[model samples]
Target: METFLGIDYPTLWFLVVGGLFSGYAILDGFDFGAGAWHLFFKKEESRRIALNAVGPVWDGNEVWLVIGGGALFAGFPVMYASMFSAMYIPFILFLLFIILRAVSIEFRSKEEMLWWRKMWDISYSVSSIMLAFLLGVVLGNVLQGIPLGENFEYQGGPLLEFLNPYAIMVGLTTLALFMTHGAIYLLMKTEGRLFAKLTILVKRGIIFFVVIFGITTIYTLIYIPHLSDTFREDPVMFAVPLATFLCIANVPRLAMKHRYKLAFLFSALSMSFMLMLIAIELYPVLLISTIDPQYSITVYNAASSEKSLGIMLNIVAIGAPLVLAYTVFVYSTFKGKVKMDETSY
Candidate 1:
């Protein structure tokens, strides 16, 4: 077992994969959140402003998703194969929505007809909402455990079985969280009446997220006891959740103080913390097998060869910083309120 800073290659790759996805969730999350609020703005000008708020960086943000998916496939091919196969339907739907979203964003303002714009607006919003929800549903199912039979094969009943109550709840919670996150982003990128409207929307979004989050938390505690086991075993692990709560609480507080920049920062932090909690809970095990615990895909069983991981880690060491630098440069270049020029989306 090769080690990197006292952590084995498999565990180190696990952290790498997790970090990539966490970056995806934080970056693309606001895009989905912003798109989800498309139809909420009634006027054409307002809608365009909202659309343009994310227009500059939305595609760049999706780079994280691409990198994250590639990392997963490279780092843990077995777990990737098993999870993708089991959740094939949802992933297909996710792909469909992703295409629809990109199309809507690119083509919505190309035509002068009101009907055409309305059609794309609806497509964009619905696709955005579903995309966010599906991400959560997948996460919930992963947390809940899938039916893996012999040889890490999926033995789940049917496609619709993925839509269990817990998964749906998690999906809705994800949607709410994204909507709130998007609203805060909008606040930073708008002014005057649109800004005032977003302030109200942000408040409502916060309440919506907090309520759904509370219900989801209660349900997880009551129904999925395994998620909390790690915290119970080590009292210090409780600090993560506590910090997550504080970060979440700070979003609204900063928003109320008209400090949307910090609000957005905290929103991104809260998301990072939540994913961290998930990683802590599911360490070692990449995908749990409900059919037989022994068949579960774990870090050790699912990872690629140590040599491959070491080589990739070296590549990532060079590539990741470049990607991060590019991302920072893009955002810094397009910082502040969106101005609708002729080329605007």
Candidate 2:
């Protein structure tokens, strides 16, 4: 119940950051997921509809990620430094995909050429694939811990350390989640034949996602024993993921009814639950000390000084709503079924 700027700082920070990330995921996850299924459409026209539904909104959605980064740097500088330094290679690749995906989306539409469109489609799919993988890797490294040494520095090591068996497995699971998310998004945002096809794909994806996610959960328990304590301690923590999965599990029924919003909401719930689980596992440790647990960076270790955090609290309160309001305005104005016959692509 600590207060900052005449308001509770910790609560506000968590609420703001959580809301921003959750909002971003709920909105953009589908688009990212939908684009991830780019390879599914052999025909350019069908792909166009899927692309159009997300194109207007995808880049804007990612602004939340940028905002999250800014907040971390400003309010959680130690976590930022440690994470960026340790995960430098993956982060760079992730950015490259983001930039390429954004550029390809715009450039592909300018030309009516089939090859250009196909290239962009591949770029989008490739970028989407990498995006999901990088996300899981980031989460895995954070929760699972990376190589840190004396005084909490990212003691660079062989690339293999980052690509350990568990890390790779987690990457695969994340890719599956994004694929399902993209498929569900397509079902929600588009209509006609494209929507029907997307609906089927998403429905099918649910089963696979469930099995993969289950296996990953078990593996995570065994692979990263340190994380199990958090999950074991709180029975309710498991409910978030279950609730999210239940939404995905029932997406088939919802999709057939053309309940696009609910479908997407469920898809978002699934992803969010998984993310929450990760955060729970990482709880107090913002940056773990690989050399010694004594040198770890918890919220207390990585968070800014009380006074500085107080100042940041005021700044975030002002900035967050403006971003969310604009984002919502853009989406609401753009909402509804996407038609390929229209000026799409």
Candidate 3:
């Protein structure tokens, strides 16, 4: 329970892990979003433009996910083991689709055959959509609580239990959110007929997201009331959801005004706020237990030793900035519209 700046090691490590995942969601979100729109661009040039829009930084964005995973294992080994064990099938499918998506991106252009390119195009789009949906499914299950027993082991039934109604709703919501996010990115990178198409898509994306988000919100309030308990107890936490709504609403408004840069920023902000809300709702508790309260994994119970967390903090302090700088540099270097050339993705 060693304290730094009035915060303990476990809480600090929790923030670190949350921040890393938030970084991944905001950075690679648009990448997944872009890929999610792959099939929409039927023309070969349009598809190539869409791919190249994310080419410079798609792989680099995944660095945050890798770091986030490592940090989770290092900081909360028990939570990592138990959560992974419980969601083994979903995570495995996640990994498989990740590889397929990467392969689709890398191999799509290797051969110019129509069938070859079309096949990979479908693969890329399907993989991206599924990845986004699966992420939401995992998040839904976490929010809904897992059936954990002694030693934090899962006490759930069959693996298919992971696909309950709530999880599927969240999955579909996540897909819509990411699709909207991707449309905003494409709007920024495309022009002419493509830009016009994206403009229409962005509008549709907004409606799609709003409808799904509304359903998810109502469902959570009615069925998953516990998540709102924190906000009810602490009035200040209301700001998080309020900000999220504002950001979400601003996306379509800004897009309509043709202010895409700001729209994209708001889209990213909307993502950041959603995650912040999750953190607000789940702080101290990493994984909740449906079996019993005693079986839940809290930051206090699940964290590594104080000394270990302190050491890792030092490493992250040094490494995170470097990673941030690299991200900024890459984006800055590739800023503005994607121009096709001899070496475009």
Q: Would you estimate the TM-scores of all the predictions?
A: 0.99, 0.90, 0.99
Query: Where in model 1 is the C-alpha error above 4 Å?
Result: none
Which candidate has the top score in lDDT? 1
Candidate 3: residue 100 lDDT (0-100):
99
Among residues 3 or more apart in sequence or in different chains, the pairs in candidate 1 whose N, CA or C atoms overlap within 3 Å are: none
Task: Compare candidates 1 and 2 on TM-score and give the better one.
Answer: 1
Give the per-residue lDDT of model 1 (tens digit) for 325-344.
Answer: 99999999999888888898
C-alpha lDDT of residue 72 in model 3: 97
Q: Residue by residue across 288-330, what tens digits does model 2's lDDT show?
A: 7667787777676677777777788778778878887898799
The TM-score obtained by model 3 is 0.99
**Can you rank all candidates by lDDT, best first?**
1, 3, 2
Assess candidate 3 and give its lDDT.
0.93
- The Cα local distance difference test for each model comes to 0.94, 0.75, 0.93
